[model samples]
Structures are given as C-alpha cells and as structure tokens.
Target: MITEKAPGKLYIAGEYAVVENGFPAILVALNQFVYCSIEPSTNGTGKIVSHQYQNNAVQWHRQGDQMIVDQRDNPFSYILSAIQVTEEYARTLNKPLDVYDLHIDSELDSASGKKYGLGSSAAVTVATVKALCQFYHLPVNNDRIFKLAAIAHFAVQGNGSLGDVAASVYGGWIAYHSFDRQWLAEQRKFLDLTTLLNLPWPNLKIETLTAPANLALVIGWTGKPASTSQLVDKISLFKARQQAQYQEFLNASRQCIQRMINGFHAGSLEMIQTEIRYNRSLLQELARRSGVQIETPVLKQLCQIAEQFGGAAKTSGAGGGDCGIVAIDAQADLQSMINQWTAENIEHLPLAVHFMNNVHRYTIKLK
Candidate 1:
C-alpha cells in the first residue's frame, strides 16, 4: 500500500483579487490533512472509499486503461479527476496501470462533518495524485505533484486562484501568484499531460515564506460554512458590472501582498500585521461594492476580539462564514483572546503550520 497526505490551507491575504491572472496571495498549510492510500487489488475490481461521503465506497473498473465510475459528483468528482489525470500521465511515461483500491480520510473537517474552510477539496486532490504517482513509482517532485494536482482541480472547479493547491503540495507558508488559466485551456487542446506539466506556466509563481520568531498564528471558526465558488461567482458578476472599482481592488490587493512578502523577508512582524489589517479592509471594501459578504457578523466579532488583544485578524477565504485568521505577538494574551472567542461562540482551532523538508522553492515576484 502507498499512502500520501496533503495539508489543508488558510488564505492569509489576497482572496478575491488572486483569482485574476498574476495576482498574488499568501496562504499557510495547516497540520490538518487529507490522507490517500492505494493498495493493489487482486479481485480485478477497484474501489474508492471515503467515510465523509453518504455512501462509504464507490466501485470502479478499468475498461481499456480507463477507470470508469457510475457516480461522478461532489467529492467523487475531485477524486476521479485526479485518478484520470494521473493515469493519463502514467500512460505518457509508458508505465503500466493496475487495479487498486484507493481510500481517503480527512481531518480537515469537524467531527460533525462541518467544514472548517481548510481547503479539503484541494488537499484531497493533491493527496490522491501523490499517492498514485508513488504507486506507479513515477519519479516526481513537489512541482510535478503540484502541477498535476492543479490540473485535476481546475478540470473540476474551473475557477479560483489555486493557492490552496499550492499550499497543499508545498506544505508551508507560501506566496502564490496564479497562472493564466486561459493559456492553460488553449494549450490543453493539443498538448499532452507530460508536455503541459513541463512548461513554465505564465504568471505562475510559488515561493516559501518565513514568519518572524515573535509571531504567532491563530485560527477561529465561525461554525458556518460558506460556498467559496458561489461568493466568487457573485464577485465576478460585480466585476462585470463595475469594472473600474474591481480593477482598483485588484491593484490594492496586489500591493498589499507585496508588502506582506517584504515583511516576511525582513523578519518584520509589525509590517506583516499591518498588511494583514490592510488586506482585511480591502476585502471588506470589495464585499461592500460587490454585495458579497466576505466577512460575516461573527467573523467581524472574531476580528474585533483579536484586535482588542493586539493581534491582526481577517476572514481567511471567500468568507461568508468559516474561519478567521490572526497574526499576533508570541507573547500576547492569547488565552484571553481565546476565552473571548469562546464567549462569542467561535471555536479556536489549535493548528500549527505544516512544513515539508527539501521541497523546491520558487523566487518571489509580484506582478
């Protein structure tokens, strides 16, 4: 059996604007993960199993090197996309494919099956692709895994910045600039998977970031799940209706992320915190203009309490509701903040940054 895992992620800055090509976002991988394990099957049939779904398992079969499933929806969509793309790449390598039972388990959600806004879908896609690559004994690195996973994710979702996918594959604090999806779509019309993976995608960048020694990260859950895609779609419509304001938001977000990146490099926690606060304000403005609630009342309260405790806080993702992140001094009154969040019915997630050693690093360049 081959097992692989990818960590869940939170957007530290640059949410709505990062969807545009070349826009930068900062995200951190959390210790929570989705694990995928593949085992060779002798019964000439394959199964995909996940306890999170309604049915515990879905059976699959290989028909002339193609894995076919009866139901392709929701959670299965990402898994199936990963399997198909990975198998296609393996065929490009002239590698033989075999029947295997794939199992998935996730800690990215709550015990009650509520999402924590930790990018579970992206984590599962990355984990599935990595597990299959390992099973086929394909020589792959972080970049390869990331590319394959991103392709699979885009095939299903068809939108978003893909920063979560990068965070999952790289497993650390990263500054990610999205690639040109239109370019990718056009290339996919004729290019093979292996060829596509080898190309230096336009505007795509992923760079590791370091936090100051005195900085501490905190996460609080609003216990309300938000559909990121729905909020993004609303914002897209707003962009069409209000082009000038949208561009201004994008430019402001780009500048804010660049400053935050500089703070990381200079080991300046104050600078990072200031930028975090600025980013939050940018998102709030976007939400107001777009008529999308990027931050809910609960998230607002969460941030206010953090500020009262001398921390910088903001809604993590597309954020109608989900989780809010805070960056604070390591010696701040974290316990008091947590107690206040508890009083406000917010759940404090005790998560640490997840990191992987010897991963490939990209240079930081903001466009």
Candidate 2:
C-alpha cells in the first residue's frame, strides 16, 4: 500500500490583497493534515474511498487515452486533478499516468463544528497535489507544488491568493507578499517575515519542531457556515468600484498585523491588547465601508469577551458568517472566559499562530 500525508494552512496576513497585486501574505502549515493511500488493482479500474467523511466511493475507468470518472462527494476532485496534472507533466517526458486505486481522508472538517474562513477546498487541492506527487514520485518542491495547486484551485474555485496554500505547504508563521514574477511560468515570490508581531502565544505545533510557546487562543462559533468562493467572487466584482477604499483598508490591515507582530515579540500584554483592537477596528471598518456586514453583533461580543483576557479577538475566516480566532497572551483571564463559553455551548480550541514561510514537500516509499 502507498500512503502519504500533507499539511494544511491558515493565512496570517494578505487574505484579500494577496491576489490583488501579488501582495505579501503570511501563513502556516497546521498540525492538521490530509492523508491519501493508494493500492493498484489488477483490474483496469480505480476506486476512491473515504475513511473519515460521510461520502460514497468514487469509481473510475480508463477508456483508451482518457480516465472516465463517476464521483459522489467533491473531495475526489483533488486526487483526480493531481493525477491529471502529474500525468500531463509526465507525458512531456514520454510517460503514462499511474493507474491505481486511491483513498483520501482529512482532519480539517468536523462533521459539523468550528468553521473558519480559510477555504477547505484549497486545503483539498493542497492535499491532492501532495498525494499526486507521491503517486507519481515526481521531483516537485514547495513552489512547484503551490504552482500546481494554484492551477487546480483555479480550475474549481477560480482565483484566490494562495496565501494559505503557501503556508499549508510550508508550515509555521509567514509574512508573504506575492510578486508575480515568472521563471518558466508565472509564479508567486513570497518574501516571508519570520518575526510577526500579532501572532498568538502557543503556536500550534504540526511537526513538533515549531512550538512557539508564548501563544494562546480560543475559537468562537457563530453557528453559520459560509463559503469563501461566493464571498471572494462578490469582492472581486466590487473591487473596481471600491478599489481606492479597499487599498486603504488593506493598508490598515497590514499595519495592524505588523503592530500585532511587534506586540507579540515585545512581551507586552498592553501592546498586544492595543494591536488587537486596532486590527479589529480596521476589519470592522472594511466591512462597514464595503457594506458586507461580515461581522455580526454576536461575533463582536465574542471578541469583547476574549479581549477581557490578555489577548485580542477577531473573526477567523471569510466574514459573511463563520468562526473567529482570539489572540491572547500567557497570563490572562482565559480560564474564566472558557468557563462562560462552555456554558454557552462554545468550545475553546487550542490556539495557533501561523508559523511557515514556504510550501513544503514530504516523501515516503512502500516496498
């Protein structure tokens, strides 16, 4: 059996503008990941099985030069895209695609809980590229992996920043700015910052080597599921009309993120607290100006409560409605806040700070 696991990412900065002008973005590969295992069949057909998600098996068959498919859930899209991309690349070197049965599972989605603004689809794409690399044994690196993932993401989700994509692939906190300069093909150049100010205390460790212990956080659920695709499209459509204002808000966001980073490093709770408010104010202003109302009153309430502790609070993912992440320091009123949230059916997730600068590749072989 052939098995492989690949990382997922969270965007620390450049959420919207990373696509605007290849602006800088920061992200980190999370401890959570997606894994795929494949086994070749003597028969000339393939099947995709899911161990974790509540989905049916996807079946496929080879017809002359094409691999025909029948899928139930959408997760299989990644595996197929990976196969097609790899197969196309291999063909340039006089190679044929690997014909095999595959299974995929991920830890990103809960059956129904804690939704963040990060795109789950993008994570699937990242995992797909990783699994495809293992299946084909391609000599692909982090940048190349993200380039391919961008293609897959484009195929389905249209255009996105690839901020989280870079982080998911690389791991750790990153300060990324996208520069659309191409070597062979156009790709993003991420000039990442290792030291970010606003990152939470206990930076969740995915590989055990990057344990930024001074961070702490809690997640608040708005009990609503929001899709990044639609929100992204709406923003793009409105970009022209709101270009000037958007740029200004983004500039403010960058400033807030930088200030947060400074506060995080200075070991000053006051600084951290102040920066969080600043960041939250900018986000609120963006939503108000755009008339997007991404932040609900309840969400704002959660942030206020989290702020009562040593950290600042804000929403996590896209804004229409989803979960939010709170950034806190070591010694605060965190436990009491958790107690109150527990009574409200809100759960506290282990906090994390984005901690990666590059997309990463891992390999394992089966005999």
Candidate 3:
C-alpha cells in the first residue's frame, strides 16, 4: 500500500487578477491535508473509497481503451480523472499499468464537514496523481505531477487559476502565475493526452517565497461557505463591463503583490503591513466598481477587528465568504484578536505557517 498526503491552501493575495493574463498571486499551504491511499489489486479493476463524497465508494475498470465506473453518480470524478490521465501517460511510454483501490480522506474541514474554503479539490487531485505515479513507478517528478494535477483539475472544473494545485504540489509559501487556460483549452482540440503533457506550459511562474520573520499568520473562518466560481464570475462580468476601471485595478493589484513579495524577501514587516492594507483597500474599491460584494459584511468586520488589534487583514481567495487572513507582529495582541473574533462569532482556525524545506512533493509512504 502507498499513501500520499498533500496540504490545502490559502490565497494570501492576488485572487481575480491571476485569472487574467497570468498575473502573480501568493499562496500558503495549510498544515491541513487531503490523503490518498492506493494499493494494487489483482482483479484488473479499480475502486475508490471517499467518505467525503455522498456516494462513498465507486468501482471502475478499464474497457479496451476507456475507463468505466460502476456508479453513475461518480463521486470521485477528480480521482478517476487522475487515474485515466496517468494511465494514458503510462501507455505513451509503453509502461505497464495496474489496477488499484484508492481510499481518500481529508483533515481540512470541521468535524461536521464544513469546509473552511481550503482548496480541497486541488489537494485531492495532487495527492491522487502523486499516489498513482508512486504506485506505478512512474519517473515523474514534482513539476510533472503539478502539471498533471492541473490538467485533471481543469478537465473537471473547466476553468481555474491552479494556485491551489501549485501550493499543494509545492508546500509552503509561494508566488505563482497561472498557466494560460485559454491556450490550453484551444490546444486540447488537436493535441493528444501525451502530446499535451509534453507541451511546455509557458508563462506559468512559481517561486517559493519566505514570509517576513516577524509576521504572524492568523486565519478566521466566516461560518458561511463561498463558491469561488460564482465570485470569480461576478468579478469577470464586472471586468468586462468596466474595462478601464478593471485595468487600473489590475495594475494596482500587481504592484501590491510585488510590494508584498519584496517585503517577504527583505524581511520588512512595515512593507508587508502596508501592502496588506493597500490590498484590502484595493479589493474593496474593486468590489464597489464591480457592483459585486467580494467582501461580505462579516469579512469587513473581520478586517475591522484585525485593525483594531493593530494587525492588517484581508479576505483570502475569491472570498465573498470563507476565511480572512491576518498578518501581525509582536505589537499585536494575538489573544486579544482571538477573543474579539470569538465575540463576533468568527471561528479562529488554529492554523499556522507551513514551510516546505526545499521539497516539492508530498511525503509518500509504502506499507
């Protein structure tokens, strides 16, 4: 048996901007993770067990040149896609592929199963791809696994920035530029799976970054779940309608992200704090112009609370609701922030920084 675990992620900055022309974004992998357990089976069949899904288990097998699952509900579609894509890549190299049973689990949510807007899908995709490669003895590295997971994720969701996938594949803080999904979509028309895998994903940039030495990470969950797609669509329509204003917003966002990056590298707490404030303001202004509520009232309240405690805060990810990230130093009272959040009915997540220590892939174990 082989097991792979990958961490979920929180977007520190650059949410909507990364979707357009691959602007940079910052993300941090949470200690919370999604796990995949794989074991070879002799029956020439595949099975997936995921308690997270309504339909917990789905059995599948290959038929001539296709994979067919037993259930139409298809709860583990992301895992299935990972398997099929990996199998296709293996066949291209004339390598043998074996059937396996995969069990999925996650530690990125509430006991009641309420997701704190962690990138669960991306984590699962990365873990599944890693598990398949390890089980089959594929000579794939972290970069290839990241690309494969991105492909599988796009195939399922149709569109995404893939920041979460990057964070999962390469744990720790990262500055990322999205791969061109528009180009990928067009290429899918003529390119075969193997050819697609070989195509250089130009313009996608990912660099491991360090957080400021004095910066403290605080995550607060807004009880309400958010649909990232819906929020992104709202912002996209706003961009289409208000191109000039959106352009200005994008430019500002780019600068702010850069400033934050510089701040992280220089270990400048002031630069980090200033950029966080600027980013929060810019996001709110963009929301006003877009006619979309990117930050809900509770999220605004979260910022206010953080600010009152001398910390800078902003919504993470596509956030109409979900988590808000706060950055502070010794000057800010951590306990006071938590107490205020509790008073306001916000749940302070007991999550901290996770550094990847120059490694790109998850910890894989064989049993």
Candidate 4:
C-alpha cells in the first residue's frame, strides 16, 4: 500500500480574512498527522473503508450516477470531495489513474474527549491528496499539494484558505502574504539551530518553558459542533455592513500579531500582552456583528475572572465557538487557574514546537 501523512494546524492571525483578499495568516502544523494507505484493486468492486472503530465502519460502492454510502455517521461529502479532487489533480498532471482500494488511518484525536482545535478535516484531506500523489508518481511539491487541497475544500465549502494545509505540508511558521489576487507563502526557518523543522527563532530559546509569563490561556469547549460555514457567511455579511469597524479590527489584529512576531524575535515574552489584548479587543467587535455570544456563558465568566487576575482573553478558533486563549501575567496564578478550570470541562492542551518532515517518495512492499 502507498502511504502519506499530513499535519493539523492552528491559526495565529487572519482567521476570518483568510478567504478574502489574502489576509496574513500564521499557522503551525501540530505533531498530530493523518495517514492514508491504498492498494490496487482487481475487481470492479470499488471499496472505500474508514476505520472509525467506535462507530460502524463506513463502506461504499460506486453506483451508476453516485456512490452508495452504507454508513450514515461518516459524511459522504468528504469522500466525494476527495475523489473529485484526486481526479482533477491527476488530469491536470496528465497522469493515467484508476479507482483503488483505499484505507485511511490517523492518530489524530477524533474521540470526543481529546478534541482539540487541530485541523482533523484538513489533515485527512491532505492524506488523501498525498495518496493520489503516490498513485500517479507525480512530482507534487507542498505548494501544489496545497492548491489541490484548497480545491477540495472549496468544493466542500465555498471558500477555504490554504493556511491549515500549508503549515501541515511545509511544517513551520508559514508567512502567507495576501495580494489582490492570490496568497503567497514564505517559510520561516532559523538557519543555525536545528530542531528537525521546529522553526525555532534565532534568538529565542526553545526551552524558555515558563509558558508565556505574560499570557496565561484557558481554552474551553462551547459544547456545540458549530457549523463553521454559517459563521463565516455571517461574518461576510457583517463586514459588508460594518465596513469601517471591520477594517479597524483587521488592522488591529494585524498590528497585534506582528508585534508578537517581533517579541518572539526579541526574546521578550513581556511584550506579548499588548498585542494579545489588542487582538482580543478586535475579536470582541465580532459580537456586535454576530449578534450572539460566540463566547459561552461559562467562558464569559472565565474571561471575566481571568481579567480580574490579569491580562485579556480571546476565542482562538472561529468566534462562534470552539476554544480560546487567555493572556496571564505576573499577578496571575496560571497553574492553579488552569487546574481550577480543568474541572469545569475546560482542557489545557499544551502547545509545543510541532514538526513535519519532507518526503520525496514512498516505498511499498508486499509482506
């Protein structure tokens, strides 16, 4: 079988602007990666199987017009989108191909409890695209794979930024610049200190350990399987309506994150708070447009308490729900605060320097 693995990602900036006008987005691929295994098929029986162990395994067969999905738990859109993208990419490369026996295995946390903000969907789609690369023996680079993955997501949703896919493919801090037309990607690599793709800052020590002394974070679930598209669509409408405030917030976010970048380079964790506070205020503007508290009641209380201790907080993912990061400073008890919130169904998923290794080939042999 041919195999390929892809990483999950987190957005540091430009979460909403990613789909429009090439907003600057900073993303790092987590160690959590998705794997795909495929083999040649002999019979006309096209079998697609996914090992979701806890639930029933989904099996599919190609029908005259469409695929007959047997298991309902697994969404059919993802499968169809993958196949469609695979064919399109192969055609673009002028490579001959055929449907094959496919099996996907991932160590990504899909179980309910360990659900962090990792890009599980992006990871899976990247794996599928990589499997196609193996099948066609195509000389696809990370950028090209990103294009293919973006196309798949566009088909799945309407607009999808390549931020998640790029980090997962490139494995570092990707400086994505948005122009009038397309987004350009630049790899952030520190020349001397090598940590196997950790993208370490030249002056910053990797083991500074104290966890952003100025930024204590608490990420809690909104207890909803939020529809990301709906929120995005609403955001588009909001921007169109509140053009000035939206633009201001975007600029504030940009400046804030740029400051954080400079702080990292300068090895001064102290400077991080101003920017975090700046970004948090920008996101707060979304509430007026959103007309709903994307921040849960409990989360709101948590943020209130955090502010009482020291620093500010903001929802990390899409504003409507998911997870958030709080800034902790000198006067705050971060460890105790995190421990206190853990019992309230809030999880403290540690963030570390994640890595991704470049692959030029795959060697598959019969056992």
Ranking by TM-score: 1, 3, 2, 4
State the lDDT of candidate 4 residue by residue for 299-340, as single tens digits: 565566566656466565565556566656645677776665
Residue runs of model 1 more than 4 Å from their true location after superposition: 55-73, 360-367
Model 4, TM vs. native = 0.73
Off by over 4 Å in 4: 53-76, 106-110, 113-116, 178-222, 301-312, 326-335, 359-367
Scored by Cα lDDT, where does model 2 land? 0.57
Q: Which candidate has the highest lDDT of all?
A: 1
Query: What TM-score, over all chains together, does every model reach?
Result: 0.94, 0.75, 0.89, 0.73
Please provide, for model 3 over 137-201, each residue's C-alpha lDDT reduced to its tens digit, 9 standing for 90 to 100: 78787678887888887777665598898889888888887778888888878888677776677
What is the total number of backbone clashes in candidate 3?
0
Q: lDDT at 73 for candidate 4? A: 23
Query: How well does candidate 1 score on lDDT at residue 367?
Result: 24
Tell how far residue 97 is off in model 3, in angstroms.
2.6
Instruction: Specify the poorest-scoring 10-residue window by lDDT in model 2.
Output: 192-201
The whole-model lDDT of each prediction reads 0.91, 0.57, 0.82, 0.57
